[model samples]
Target: METRIFFNPGDSIANIHDYNEAVRQGQIFKRERHSDDLVIAKGPGDEEYAIFYAKDAVKNPGKGQKPYDVKNTL
Candidate 1:
Protein backbone atom coordinates (compact mmCIF):
# COMPACT_ATOMS: atom_id res chain seq x y z
CA MET A 1 0.00 0.00 0.00
CA GLU A 2 1.18 3.50 -0.79
CA THR A 3 0.94 6.49 1.52
CA ARG A 4 -0.44 9.81 0.28
CA ILE A 5 0.47 12.75 2.45
CA PHE A 6 -1.72 15.79 1.89
CA PHE A 7 0.53 18.34 0.12
CA ASN A 8 -0.98 20.83 2.49
CA PRO A 9 -3.39 19.43 5.01
CA GLY A 10 -4.93 22.90 5.29
CA ASP A 11 -5.74 22.92 1.59
CA SER A 12 -6.78 19.32 1.83
CA ILE A 13 -9.27 20.14 4.57
CA ALA A 14 -10.51 23.15 2.64
CA ASN A 15 -10.97 21.29 -0.65
CA ILE A 16 -11.88 17.83 0.52
CA HIS A 17 -15.53 18.09 -0.53
CA ASP A 18 -14.60 18.86 -4.11
CA TYR A 19 -12.16 15.98 -4.02
CA ASN A 20 -14.93 13.66 -2.94
CA GLU A 21 -17.12 14.83 -5.80
CA ALA A 22 -14.36 14.12 -8.30
CA VAL A 23 -13.96 10.65 -6.87
CA ARG A 24 -17.74 10.21 -7.07
CA GLN A 25 -17.67 11.20 -10.75
CA GLY A 26 -14.87 8.68 -11.27
CA GLN A 27 -12.68 11.66 -12.12
CA ILE A 28 -9.78 10.45 -10.03
CA PHE A 29 -7.14 10.26 -12.71
CA LYS A 30 -4.25 7.85 -12.33
CA ARG A 31 -1.14 7.57 -14.44
CA GLU A 32 0.39 4.41 -15.84
CA ARG A 33 3.24 3.10 -13.69
CA HIS A 34 2.90 6.33 -11.71
CA SER A 35 1.46 7.01 -8.29
CA ASP A 36 -0.01 10.41 -9.11
CA ASP A 37 -3.79 10.86 -8.99
CA LEU A 38 -5.33 14.05 -10.40
CA VAL A 39 -7.57 16.28 -8.31
CA ILE A 40 -10.60 17.57 -10.24
CA ALA A 41 -12.88 19.23 -7.69
CA LYS A 42 -12.80 21.90 -4.94
CA GLY A 43 -15.16 21.24 -2.06
CA PRO A 44 -15.14 19.98 1.55
CA GLY A 45 -13.45 17.08 3.33
CA ASP A 46 -14.27 13.37 2.91
CA GLU A 47 -12.40 11.22 5.43
CA GLU A 48 -12.70 8.33 3.04
CA TYR A 49 -10.08 10.07 0.87
CA ALA A 50 -7.63 13.02 0.71
CA ILE A 51 -5.49 14.44 -2.13
CA PHE A 52 -1.92 15.59 -2.64
CA TYR A 53 -2.27 18.07 -5.52
CA ALA A 54 0.27 18.51 -8.31
CA LYS A 55 1.28 22.04 -7.33
CA ASP A 56 4.07 20.37 -5.33
CA ALA A 57 4.12 16.79 -6.51
CA VAL A 58 6.95 14.60 -5.08
CA LYS A 59 6.81 11.38 -7.04
CA ASN A 60 7.41 8.00 -5.40
CA PRO A 61 10.76 7.77 -7.22
CA GLY A 62 9.75 4.25 -8.19
CA LYS A 63 6.73 2.59 -9.76
CA GLY A 64 3.30 2.40 -8.12
CA GLN A 65 2.85 5.15 -5.54
CA LYS A 66 -0.38 7.04 -4.82
CA PRO A 67 -0.56 10.81 -4.49
CA TYR A 68 -2.67 13.50 -6.23
CA ASP A 69 -1.97 15.56 -9.35
CA VAL A 70 -3.66 17.53 -12.21
CA LYS A 71 -3.83 17.44 -16.03
CA ASN A 72 -6.99 15.48 -16.67
CA THR A 73 -8.64 15.05 -20.09
CA LEU A 74 -11.67 13.17 -18.85
Candidate 2:
Protein backbone atom coordinates (compact mmCIF):
# COMPACT_ATOMS: atom_id res chain seq x y z
CA MET A 1 0.00 0.00 0.00
CA GLU A 2 1.01 3.58 -0.58
CA THR A 3 0.84 6.37 1.96
CA ARG A 4 -0.23 9.89 1.17
CA ILE A 5 -0.21 13.32 2.83
CA PHE A 6 -2.65 16.14 2.19
CA PHE A 7 -1.51 19.77 2.04
CA ASN A 8 -4.07 22.54 2.15
CA PRO A 9 -4.20 25.16 -0.58
CA GLY A 10 -4.18 28.91 -0.12
CA ASP A 11 -6.42 31.70 -1.39
CA SER A 12 -6.68 32.11 -5.16
CA ILE A 13 -4.64 34.57 -7.20
CA ALA A 14 -6.47 34.98 -10.46
CA ASN A 15 -4.86 34.80 -13.92
CA ILE A 16 -1.20 33.90 -13.63
CA HIS A 17 0.65 32.78 -16.76
CA ASP A 18 3.80 30.95 -15.73
CA TYR A 19 6.65 30.54 -13.19
CA ASN A 20 7.93 34.10 -13.41
CA GLU A 21 4.49 35.49 -12.67
CA ALA A 22 4.25 33.13 -9.76
CA VAL A 23 7.44 34.67 -8.39
CA ARG A 24 6.64 38.27 -9.27
CA GLN A 25 3.20 37.91 -7.71
CA GLY A 26 4.72 36.58 -4.42
CA GLN A 27 4.11 32.85 -4.64
CA ILE A 28 6.10 30.18 -2.86
CA PHE A 29 8.20 27.91 -5.02
CA LYS A 30 10.54 26.57 -2.34
CA ARG A 31 10.24 25.20 1.16
CA GLU A 32 12.50 23.59 3.77
CA ARG A 33 11.36 20.71 5.89
CA HIS A 34 13.21 18.27 8.13
CA SER A 35 12.25 15.33 5.91
CA ASP A 36 10.21 15.73 2.74
CA ASP A 37 11.45 17.90 -0.09
CA LEU A 38 8.66 20.02 -1.53
CA VAL A 39 7.65 20.90 -5.08
CA ILE A 40 5.39 23.48 -6.66
CA ALA A 41 3.06 22.22 -9.33
CA LYS A 42 0.84 24.11 -11.75
CA GLY A 43 -2.71 23.05 -12.39
CA PRO A 44 -4.41 22.98 -15.82
CA GLY A 45 -5.19 26.68 -15.48
CA ASP A 46 -1.71 27.62 -14.15
CA GLU A 47 -2.72 27.80 -10.51
CA GLU A 48 0.06 26.47 -8.30
CA TYR A 49 -0.05 23.98 -5.44
CA ALA A 50 2.23 21.95 -3.26
CA ILE A 51 3.29 18.34 -3.77
CA PHE A 52 5.26 16.84 -0.90
CA TYR A 53 7.51 13.86 -1.58
CA ALA A 54 8.67 11.31 0.95
CA LYS A 55 11.94 11.27 -0.90
CA ASP A 56 13.82 14.24 -2.30
CA ALA A 57 12.00 16.00 -5.15
CA VAL A 58 14.28 18.93 -5.80
CA LYS A 59 13.84 18.92 -9.55
CA ASN A 60 13.05 22.32 -11.09
CA PRO A 61 14.41 25.54 -9.65
CA GLY A 62 12.51 27.72 -12.15
CA LYS A 63 15.45 28.29 -14.50
CA GLY A 64 18.02 29.92 -12.17
CA GLN A 65 15.29 31.55 -10.16
CA LYS A 66 15.78 32.38 -6.51
CA PRO A 67 13.83 30.67 -3.74
CA TYR A 68 11.00 32.35 -1.87
CA ASP A 69 10.16 31.57 1.73
CA VAL A 70 6.41 32.01 1.74
CA LYS A 71 5.20 32.87 5.24
CA ASN A 72 3.14 30.30 7.13
CA THR A 73 1.79 29.75 10.61
CA LEU A 74 0.49 26.73 12.52
Candidate 3:
Protein backbone atom coordinates (compact mmCIF):
# COMPACT_ATOMS: atom_id res chain seq x y z
CA MET A 1 0.00 0.00 0.00
CA GLU A 2 1.03 3.59 -0.61
CA THR A 3 0.17 6.67 1.37
CA ARG A 4 0.73 10.37 0.75
CA ILE A 5 0.86 13.33 3.04
CA PHE A 6 -0.19 16.86 2.25
CA PHE A 7 0.25 20.20 3.93
CA ASN A 8 -1.11 23.66 3.19
CA PRO A 9 1.32 26.29 2.03
CA GLY A 10 2.78 28.49 4.78
CA ASP A 11 1.77 26.06 7.52
CA SER A 12 4.17 24.79 10.16
CA ILE A 13 6.38 22.22 8.44
CA ALA A 14 7.15 18.80 9.75
CA ASN A 15 8.79 15.66 8.45
CA ILE A 16 6.38 13.18 6.92
CA HIS A 17 6.51 9.58 8.07
CA ASP A 18 5.43 8.59 4.57
CA TYR A 19 8.86 9.62 3.38
CA ASN A 20 10.51 6.93 5.43
CA GLU A 21 7.80 4.42 4.58
CA ALA A 22 8.27 5.11 0.89
CA VAL A 23 11.95 4.51 1.24
CA ARG A 24 11.18 1.22 2.89
CA GLN A 25 8.84 0.30 0.07
CA GLY A 26 11.36 1.41 -2.57
CA GLN A 27 8.98 3.99 -3.91
CA ILE A 28 9.96 7.34 -5.30
CA PHE A 29 9.05 10.45 -3.35
CA LYS A 30 7.58 13.45 -5.10
CA ARG A 31 7.06 17.12 -4.30
CA GLU A 32 5.60 19.85 -6.51
CA ARG A 33 3.59 23.03 -6.40
CA HIS A 34 -0.14 22.36 -6.37
CA SER A 35 -0.56 25.82 -7.82
CA ASP A 36 2.18 28.14 -8.94
CA ASP A 37 0.17 31.20 -8.02
CA LEU A 38 -0.24 29.95 -4.48
CA VAL A 39 3.34 29.06 -3.66
CA ILE A 40 6.74 28.33 -5.06
CA ALA A 41 8.85 25.35 -4.10
CA LYS A 42 12.63 25.50 -3.86
CA GLY A 43 15.56 23.11 -3.61
CA PRO A 44 17.14 20.54 -5.91
CA GLY A 45 16.27 17.30 -4.23
CA ASP A 46 14.37 14.11 -5.08
CA GLU A 47 11.98 14.37 -2.17
CA GLU A 48 8.54 15.82 -2.59
CA TYR A 49 7.49 18.71 -0.38
CA ALA A 50 11.20 18.89 0.27
CA ILE A 51 10.94 22.61 0.72
CA PHE A 52 8.13 25.04 0.14
CA TYR A 53 7.80 28.81 0.49
CA ALA A 54 4.93 31.24 0.48
CA LYS A 55 4.76 35.04 0.48
CA ASP A 56 2.71 35.20 3.69
CA ALA A 57 4.13 32.10 5.35
CA VAL A 58 6.28 34.16 7.61
CA LYS A 59 6.09 37.11 9.97
CA ASN A 60 8.53 39.16 7.91
CA PRO A 61 6.94 38.12 4.67
CA GLY A 62 9.42 40.09 2.54
CA LYS A 63 12.57 39.17 4.41
CA GLY A 64 14.02 37.24 1.55
CA GLN A 65 13.49 33.45 1.69
CA LYS A 66 12.71 31.94 5.05
CA PRO A 67 14.71 28.97 6.27
CA TYR A 68 13.17 25.65 7.29
CA ASP A 69 14.57 23.71 10.17
CA VAL A 70 15.26 20.67 8.06
CA LYS A 71 17.43 19.28 10.82
CA ASN A 72 16.19 16.68 13.26
CA THR A 73 13.91 18.13 15.90
CA LEU A 74 14.92 15.60 18.49
Question: Which numbered prediction scores highest in TM-score against the true structure?
Answer: 1
**TM-score of each predicted structure versus truth:** 0.28, 0.25, 0.19
* Deviation (Å) of 54 in candidate 1: 2.6
Q: Please count the clashing residue pairs in each candidate, in the order shown.
A: 7, 0, 3
Model 1 poorest ten-residue lDDT run: 40-49
TM-score of 3: 0.19
What does candidate 3's lDDT look like per residue over 3-69, in tens digits? Answer: 2223343353323434443232222212232322222222224344332323334433243444332
Q: Write the per-residue lDDT of candidate 2 for residues 25-48, one digit (tens) a residue.
A: 332433323323333334333344
Give the distance in Å from residue 3's predicted Cα in candidate 3 to where it truly belongs.
30
Deviating ranges (above 4 Å) for candidate 2: 1-10, 27-40, 44-74
The 0-to-1 C-alpha lDDT of every candidate, in the order given, reads 0.39, 0.33, 0.31
Which residue pairs clash in candidate 3? Answer: 30-48, 31-48, 31-49
Question: Per-residue alpha-carbon lDDT of model 1 for 1-74, expressed as tens digits?
Answer: 33333244444422434544655444433443343444442212333344444553444533433344332322
Better of 1 and 2 by lDDT: 1
Please give the lDDT score for candidate 1: 0.39
Off by over 4 Å in 1: 13-22, 25-46, 58-74
